[model samples]
Target: MPTPLAETLTQLRIGNQKFLIDFYQRSRHLFARWAQRKHQLPPDKAHGLLQDTLLDFYDHVADGRITRMPEDLRAYLYGMAQERIAAHVPAHQPLPAAEASRRQRLLAQFNQLSTDCQQVLTYFYFRGYHFEKMGGKMGFPNATVARRQKSVCLRKLYDLVRGGYEPITGEVV
Candidate 1:
């Protein structure tokens, strides 16, 4: 007889919603513990990986990739979690002296940007705020406005970092 997971996998392949929910519920805890304890992905990134791997697994099964259900479904989920983390995580390294100097200079310029620019950039890039929420917080009319603001601020920051200053006055141009 097919295992519960094997039967569920057959239904999951055909885009069965209940099976997908069952899969998610069954795998969620293992995905969390393994992604953090074994892989050391930050909590937020790990959470994101959980959702992404779920979708990826569904996509793979939907596209005829998982022809036969694996003997161990939890192990399969853990493997997928590890693969997803590996694909996204950057290798850790100490900054070179030249790059450190550039970073310091960039930080100084970033600090000199308008307070609005600082808030917008910090919210989006550093704090990971959604554009919609950031727009509401920053009192913008909508996310589109916040997105445009982010683009303009990012360009100004890049320019400032790349030496876009007055030749004699040393003021930002």
Candidate 2:
């Protein structure tokens, strides 16, 4: 856990592992005691659940989806831990072979996009930038144009993943 004592979800969203550790330390003991009362779980299992909760919280922040944070990280982490512990298995299990392969292919195709397309997608998907702002920065006439460009890039990527098709628009490269 971060020893600074001012760790916040903002820090975690910014890729600070210290904040994650801080959350773990702050909530683990309380969650462990609660688990003892409600479940016949081993210490290790409870610990694992706490870790998973922290990771899930981190993912939500990084995914541009966590708009608000709970007032108390301890209570929030404990609540999420309760759901995870009840599952009796890791919260997110490994993907099956087909799904994993498909993901790899999609990622490969996405990586092959033009740099501008990659930047737009990253800002929109990872940083949660709105289309208008992205369009302005990228010099598109309007958000609609930016959105259409994104759609075209995605379609190109999808086709490449679906089959060994020609490049976007069949241009000889």
Candidate 3:
């Protein structure tokens, strides 16, 4: 009942590693060049943006947010990349001092987390992994367990930050 393109996307969402690799290979260079030329991003930033865009696309497909395949997949990706570029501050721009300090504090707190907690958070947020993929990578029994672990880790992080727990002394102030 699905179009070929939709089926392909479904395959991608369901862990078809070869198809995902092919999809990235097919688009990476083209997207990198397009982003660099159109948005004036540096090569590395353009490539990074492309990677993030692809992950976002995968997430959308997995979550049923993308109910219909776009007529032009490249165009859809380009639009998403453009929006991401607009949302992010350029690398050359400096973060405000207060924001930088806050980030430093948060990162310090993050470092105090248990190794498993750190890995789970990094996998979910930085690597943009779905729960199933995260479960596989972390050797969890199932996706639900992975999701629950991530939630617990995130809650711990939130409490540490909100309660002003000192990472160095391991005490709340």
Against the true structure, whose lDDT is highest? Answer: 3
Q: Name the runs in model 2 displaced over 4 angstroms.
A: 1-41, 51-75, 86-93, 125-130, 165-173
All candidates' TM-scores? Answer: 0.43, 0.53, 0.47
Evaluated against the true structure, the overall lDDT of model 2 is 0.66
Candidates 2 and 3, the one with greater lDDT = 3
- For model 2 the local lDDT of residue 116 reads 69
For model 3, the stretches where C-alpha displacement exceeds 4 angstroms are 1-3, 89-173
Model 2, residue 33: distance off in Å is 7.7
lDDT of 2 by residue, 1-173 (tens): 43322235434443556767865787677777787778866677777777777777776775555755666767777777777766765654545789557655665676566666666666566555688997897888999987887777666666677786554433211
lDDT per residue, candidate 3, 1-173, as tens digits? 53476457545544444555566788788777887788887777877777777777766775568766789888898898788778983433444789658756776788777778877876786556899999999999899999998998888889899985854322221
Between the candidate structures 2 and 3, which one is better when assessed by TM-score?
Answer: 2
lDDT of 1 by residue, 10-97 (tens): 4554345576576677766666676678877676666567666666677676556776667776678678777755676443333478
Which residue pairs does candidate 3 place in steric collision?
none
lDDT of candidate 1 vs native? 0.67
**Each candidate: RMSD to true structure?**
16.2, 7.0, 10.9
Candidate with top TM-score is 2
